[model samples]
Target chain A: AQTVTQSQPEMSVQEAETVTLSCTYDTSESDYYLFWYKQPPSRQMILVIRQEAYKQQNATENRFSVNFQKAAKSFSLKISDSQLGDAAMYFCAYMEGGTSYGKLTFGQGTILTVHP
Target chain B: EPEVTQTPSHQVTQMGQEVILRCVPISNHLYFYWYRQILGQKVEFLVSFYNNEISEKSEIFDDQFSVERPDGSNFTLKIRSTKLEDSAMYFCASRAFFGANVLTFGAGSRLTVL
Candidate 1:
């Protein structure tokens, strides 16, 4: 079974500071995709960033980015210039790139709190 | 700027009763999915559908759970007999054929089985 692990249960950052949320996964498949999703109190899950396993370059989307260490099987999300709106339950998810389409294995999630 | 939409933002049902959660995925999307998040737990994948057939399902999806695309526009999940453990925030998601990794999720339907 594939499993994603987010070690921190909760994290907090002052407004304008940067924070990194750690994630690691165990999978036999060589090719896959890693994702970071943010769920606000509204319960809507929004995509933050995504990284393809084969890519040596990490993925970055505006304020969000990922440090993907394929060797370590670690994919961590970094939120830069954090704003109050970034406060939410952040989840790290993994999806197979080849067959077994679209099923995402997710971590237990890290609740992010942004202080004003 | 299309997004997946789900109905009945919240539903409360008695144990052993039936419940149906409805979703309307973004038009033109070829893949659909259902996921659930129990409070204080990880979000779990329930099922995935494509081309009128199930593509994948998690262990959490079993005989008691069924999915259907009754019409071209609507996808629904039916729980044969609800259990208290079934209570969770159920999310419907859809993805474009090309970018399968990017799934657009609905606001979600919170199901509470008492």
Candidate 2:
């Protein structure tokens, strides 16, 4: 079974600054997908960005980006120019490749606090 | 972009009662799923539905739980007997057949079994 681990349970960042949330995974499958999801206090989960294992370039969505190291089994999310709206419970997820049913394995989550 | 929508944002039911959580997945998406989050725990996958059938299910989806897509737009999850342990936020998600495996999720429905 594949498992995703988010070591940082809580993180804080000042407005307009940058912060990184760390994530790691255990999977034997050579091909897979990684994603970062943001759940606000309202409890709506929103997709932040995604990275494909086969791609060497990291994924970026505006101020959100990922540092994906496949060989190291690490996928970390970077939030630049952080705004108060970026505050949320962030989750790292993993999914198997090739004919996947879209079932996701999620991490414990990291609570990000962005200070103004 | 289209979004998945769920009904009864919050449900309070007594134990042993049957409760059905409903969802309307994105119209064109082919894959649908149900996941739950127990209070402070990580979100867990319960079941996945595709082509009007269950593609896969987790151990947590016991016989007490079942899913249905009665109409073209409505996908429902029915729990035969609710327990206090079943109190959690139930989320419905869907994804298109061709994408980066991106699953669009609905605002979860909080089910509280008393």
Candidate 3:
């Protein structure tokens, strides 16, 4: 079984600043995918960014990027130029890659607060 | 943009009563799933349906729970006898047959069992 852990329960960043949310996972499988999802007060899960284990290069999506260290089993999300809209509960998720698919194991979550 | 739709954004029911949550996935999606999140916990997968049958289910999906795609567009999850602990937000998601396994989720239906 794979388990994702988000050590920080809460994080705050000043507007226009950068913030990094930490995440770590324990999985024996060599092939897998890591994802960061955001849930606003409305509770809608939105995809932030994703990283494939095979890719040594980190994945970047606009202001959102991931620092994926496969050897350390760590995948952290970085939000640059944080805005008020970035305030939400961020979750780190893990999914099996190979033949199996779709079931996502999520972390406890980190509540992000973007201060103006 | 295409999105997953779920009905009864909020539902209130008494313990021991039956409750059904409905969702309409993307038109072209081939896989459907049900997940839930307690007040402050992480989202947990309940079940996944493919080809009109359940392909995967977690232990949380017990005998009391059931899922059906009764028609061409609706996917529903029924809790035979709800309990107070069942109060949570239920999310419906769908994925296209071909993709990086990205799932689009609905806004979620908040169930309050008293």
Name the candidate that leads on DockQ.
1
DockQ of 2: 0.85
The per-candidate TM-score of the B chain, in the order shown, comes to 0.97, 0.97, 0.98
Candidate 2, position A34, lDDT: 95
lDDT (10s digit) by residue, model 2, range B1-114: 689999999999999999999999999988899999998889999999988999999999999999999999999999999999999999999988856488999999999999
Writing each residue's lDDT as its tens digit, candidate 3 over B1-114 gives 999999899999999999999999999999899999999999999999999999899999999999999999999999999999999999999989845568899999999999
Where model 1 places Cα greater than 4 Å from the true spot, the runs are none
Cα-based lDDT at residue A18, candidate 1 = 100
What is the per-residue lDDT of model 2 for residues A12-88, given as tens digits with 9 covering 90 to 100? 99999999999999999988999999999998999999999999999999999999999999999999999999999
lDDT per residue as tens, model 1, B1-78: 898999999999999999999999999999999999998888999999998999889889999999999999999999
CA lDDT, candidate 1, residue B114: 96
Order of all candidates by DockQ, from best down to worst?
1, 2, 3
The deviation in Å at residue B33 for candidate 2 is 0.2
DockQ for each model: 0.87, 0.85, 0.84
CAPRI accuracy category, model 1: high
